[model samples]
Target: MNRRHFLGSSGGLLAGLALPTLASAAVAAPSATGSAASSSAGGRGYRPVVTLGGRTLGFRLNNGVKEFHLIAEEVEQEVAPGMSARFWGYNGGSPGPTIEAVEGDTVRIFVSNRLPEHTTIHWHGLLLPNGMDGVGGLNQPQIKPGETFRYEFRLTKSGTFMYHPHADETLQMAQGMMGLFIVHPKNARERPVDRDYAFLLASYKIDPGTRRPDPSEMTDFNLWTFNSRTFPAIPPLLARTGERVRIRVGNLTMTNHPIHLHGHDFRVTGTDGGWIPAAAQWPEVTTDVAVGQMRVIEFIANAPGDWAFHCHKSHHTMGPMGHGVPNLVGVDQKAATAKLEKLFDGQHYMEMGSSGMAEMQDMAAMGSMMPLPTNTLPMMTGEGPFGPIEMGGMFTTLKVRDSLAPNDERDPGWYTHPQGSVANKVDPKRTDGLPR
Candidate 1:
């Protein structure tokens, strides 16, 4: 989004303009909260959180309270290069901007409803006055379209939380109305991390060649995402070697995700309730984040490489893989290809899935001949320097390198392995690194 979208000096904001330029590639989440590379930039004595594929929400001071404005509106959100969908979100993006504040700070939030119907923001897992809890009808009246509602509360705890609609939740949330709310401890004397990252896991079931997501589909969702984006589009999490890295993940989808990290063991240091005390934490390579819950994990980025970080559920790492496709594996389709060609009057037809779907990676190379539908991403991924990356959706890499500019969040591209370290051919015809 343009800086003008949220750079208001005063609490004043423009009328709710909810239709995001859905194909706009630049807006997602912030590279780092409070500016991680520039310590103490967004907060005092506290490291900023990095919302992958997102940016942090900026605020203004009003009297003694921190004031913010969130416009609930419709958006055209890009899931990847070839896919865009009609989504509803705060501001202009899905998994709306991260809100960073300190515990004990008084906050007054103005929510403008630009949505077609009534909406309310339920502060999931935060203890606050009943009226400020944002449960639509129970705690307060719904913010009807074109109306603005105010929520004032003092942060009583520090943790990773979320905010989404409490009214017409099934339709609203399924349309991608959500964002992360992060509160830091106020004391400021605690251990600070070198690189802190946060993101929300979301899923969509947009049919192939469609522009709007289906909110009614309960299961069999095909498009999984990190901050409403798929792999090759979602930027990698960058860090300096040996840095103490913190990653906060929240799940809004109905299913659970066993989030796994490659080349590092981390400890679960926080949850939806609050930060976990040191004595209670343990080391693990993967942690499960359940529906409507959050988990904070931390570890030393001692290893240097482009390490894989993603959900462990195999299907979650793929795109638009709708259920019930014909099981054509192990069936030789060369004869079928000839028949297809004959039926098409000599137009070449390529066989797919008989030898498994890996051939789809070369779909781009084949160009117009491939039968992929419009407005859908391929199940696999974009090309790495080596070849097709065998992943997508809810997946990204943590690029920990020995040399990176302080606070730099740009993708460093592919990792170059030392010559002898990469696997090589072992037959006699192979290069004679060792005596053949």
Candidate 2:
């Protein structure tokens, strides 16, 4: 879709997430000076090739981020005994792996297309070389099936970024094929927080009639999720009360998402790699994640209830099964629906009965029986700690358990201790610390 189409399709800019026009960014033309330099630097560069399917495609991991291969392949997963459908994935699953690296590190990624159609991988919200931006045929050409493309750049700045097919982005991304990239800072902080969690929040637009994904439909973003699965299917982000927690957010949708967390206003520490000191950090009840953007915030899990964290876009918290258009049938069907309505009587987005009630009822009905797939927080749709509205299918609880030891039992918000904190990670100041 063109720029106009993307923005307009979302019914104008999402409340507070309007982007500066591309013209204002002055990116309409490539800098001749930089292109010349990038060309010369291209030769003899470390050719890091990753095989796509069976063909080895080459790429270079320049700065520090290790280059990996991202392939969009179609896989058939058994959702039921005899029910199977093709799913789009990166590496292998939807909301791909979390790529952890340090700030100021250069990373390269080789993208190979194995699908039957053309696609591109956009490094959502990453500041990289124009050629590596992954806008098919805009900055570079589309990677046709069986073709290989290299994306090389430095993680000069980092916070949270994601990769997803830019071509037919609405469709490709909706079918899955998204992943996270986290760049750590060279100057590590001695914070007391114990755990770090990266969230891949995405919403899928599924046609209610077919109960399948339809990227072409502009207003059907039906299922909202975290890490591809709904709650119950995913685990909770539990920690002891008063423990510090860091949550990195990656929003890959075309619309902005206001992620609301019940009972806490976490201090935002960083925005896409640049650090805002503690003094500058502010506590907000709801953090806004703009389309194709990233933000990192920290909070103390001091509350004790089953706190709900989900997109404020009411519809996003629902699934296709639950968001059915009301049927103006006979009074019997309507009465049965009215009885079901009592279940969500005091819940959110449950006002205007038929229009809103049918969808949720259908979603709950479908999810109640269908086996939930993965169990990672934030939960994907059709899974765990689901549906009290905000906490329903769209949320997973933060089950904070009291702990005095630094064990896996303790939920370390944003800290990962590998080999005693100096594991495979390298200090950005050191050249040979980690490979680019």
Q: What is the C-alpha lDDT of each candidate?
A: 0.81, 0.54
Q: Which stretches of candidate 1 lie over 4 Å from their true place?
A: 1-35, 38-43, 363-371, 428-436
lDDT of model 2, residue 239: 53
Report the lDDT tens digits of candidate 2 across residue range 40-155. 11111111111101111112222323345566787553222222334687655566544544556565566668788999888776788898888887998889999877777877
Q: Please name the candidate that would achieve the greatest TM-score relative to the true structure.
A: 1
Ten-residue stretch with the least lDDT total in model 2: 31-40
Per-model TM against the reference: 0.89, 0.63
Quick one: best lDDT, which candidate? 1
Q: Roughly what TM-score does model 2 have, to 2 decimal places?
A: 0.63
Candidate 1 lands at a TM-score of: 0.89
What is the Cα-based lDDT of residue 301 in candidate 2? 80
